[model samples]
Target: MNRTLYDLAGADPALRFSPFCWRTRMALAHKDLPVETIPWRFTEKERIAFSGQGLVPVLVDGERVLHDSWAIAEYLEETYPHCPSLFGGPEAQAVTRFVNAWTDAVLHPWVGRLVVRDILDVIRPEDRGYFRESREKRFGVTLEAFVAERETVLPEFRRALQPVRLVLRAQPFLAGEAPAYADYIVFGAFMWARGASAFRLLESDDPVHAWRERMLDLFDGLARRSPGHEV
Candidate 1:
């Protein structure tokens, strides 16, 4: 089957950084599915308008069109049952849902505070204005103000990963001994940071940092091979 993904890209087309898109990309790789990713940008909404919504990570699989990372993951699991499982089973899938929710609600916001401002540096010139204005309005402050004192808040960001830290301390991956959709969900946020900023979000000794290393090594260093900061 021919699979294509509209992945969010930076000023350099190879710099794919959207956290949500990373989720889909990792999920596809987990299933051993090959995909052709089209580099997409913030202002390129018309390019993906066919998906009924303007978002990168729009998936075109055969004749079917899918949007949303979670929806695409579920579709892949059901459509390609013979492939590697993203979620171990029904019970694990249920738990993974919680991870997804926590990532979107808690982790993403925390990550945005740290690296969202940096994204402007990586995106196209046309995108910078929209990015700054929209983000400022949503955040109720300028991007500079929003991420001001990031160093001071770095500890809080690390503290927010306490749950992940506890899990990774006992296991190599968030999904038991191996990677899964749950791990991908959280890993996407790190990928977002890695692609857009040089700022270090994790210390060397952190368990979550180790887990991210393991994830980057998966699929023969698939995520690691991408254009991103070594941090």
Candidate 2:
């Protein structure tokens, strides 16, 4: 245990990662804060109940349990005041919120749907049945039926990304010079889509692509001893 709030949340390393948590984890890494990761299953309401919510990425500091991703990010900033700005300045807040909303409110649902078909669709027949059954249990549907059914979420997802893609075309990071909590929160969802399955729509030269590569560099650039693990 790191003897912090982070440890109480994620005791298992492999299970500790979720994109939402990953964003903050990456941010903490960016700021060089020592954090412990807690992994919880989507179906495991006990974990949620423990934290008084049904979400992963809960941060457990010495005595505080921070739930929401953004709030946690802010807490880290305030707690570790020595680091440079993460949310950025006056106008930066708007841009930061914009990027976060675009990903969570828009791109994620679509990406989730696409991955089920594109990535989980590739699961072996027996495993596919189990995976789909599990998904349907959490999301709704039977394995045999879900694949046979068409996802209505597709069109809406593409429509949502339109503006987001437009924004990415203007700058590599949503916050401009470098990534902020805003870039990470949004990128967290995109990372899910990218890792789970391929995004055909992403190939169009949006700053989002550059941002992903940039994150990899940032993850690799620093030493683990200075802050947290690199990536």
Candidate 3:
């Protein structure tokens, strides 16, 4: 394939579940780009060694290789100007960067606290030791201990989502009327949770939940068709 993406996956190869990868996937769909995605596992770092990194969401387009999801999105926007824009304009791109940073720093950690333990069950058997050790070292605690109070902390996660909720309450999408990179940035976290855990992260009446439903319905149920919980 001319355009290929190494997407993080679970034991089931069809389960492409990385939040970062989801960002890239949504960005690609937004740009009206076609890509062949290869399912990748955590322990398979060497598989993506060509990108000079261990992370998935590696994109190889023709001779150019890109690793970071944000970089890949930018590349797509610049390369395919004729296609739909991921960010509306320079101003939109600047604001979307803040959304990206927030998703990485605040939202991801909250989602991780809720679903990190459950991730072990979906990952490949060989990747289990590496995942647990790496995650434990990063968090300085065992997986079970890390997510032990997921139920109690669910409220905190929901509380942290107030910013997005507030924005959604006013606008249909983070980038105004139409979805953009900002929407993908936040929705990626929800996709991560949906793919790995059965946890209900939002309430039915929540505006955030409504936004997520619209996101899942995008690209003709691209995300909803994935193997994940209804919530």
Which ranges in model 3 have alpha carbons more than 4 Å from their true place? none
Residue 14, candidate 2: Cα error in Å is: 3.2
Query: Which regions in candidate 2 have their CA more than 4 angstroms from the true location?
Result: 1-17, 117-159, 198-201, 204-206, 221-231
In candidate 3, what are the lDDT values of residues 124-173, reduced to their tens digit?
A: 89999999999999999999999999999989889999999899989999
Cα distance off (Å), candidate 3, residue 65: 0.6
- Per-residue lDDT tens digits for candidate 1, residues 111-202, read 99999999999999999998898889999999999899899999999999999999988988889988899999999999999999999999
Ranking of models by lDDT? 1, 3, 2
Q: Count the backbone clashes (under 3 Å) in each candidate.
A: 0, 8, 0
TM-score of 1: 0.98
Model 3, position 72, has a per-residue lDDT of: 91
For 1-231, candidate 2 gives per-residue lDDT tens digits of: 252333211122232324576677777877877665544444455755767886656777777777777777778777767786677654765567666776676666666666555445333344455456667897676533544433554555556666655766776666666777776777676555544444343544545555666765676642121222222
**How high is each candidate's TM-score?**
0.98, 0.69, 0.98
Clash-forming residue pairs, model 1: none
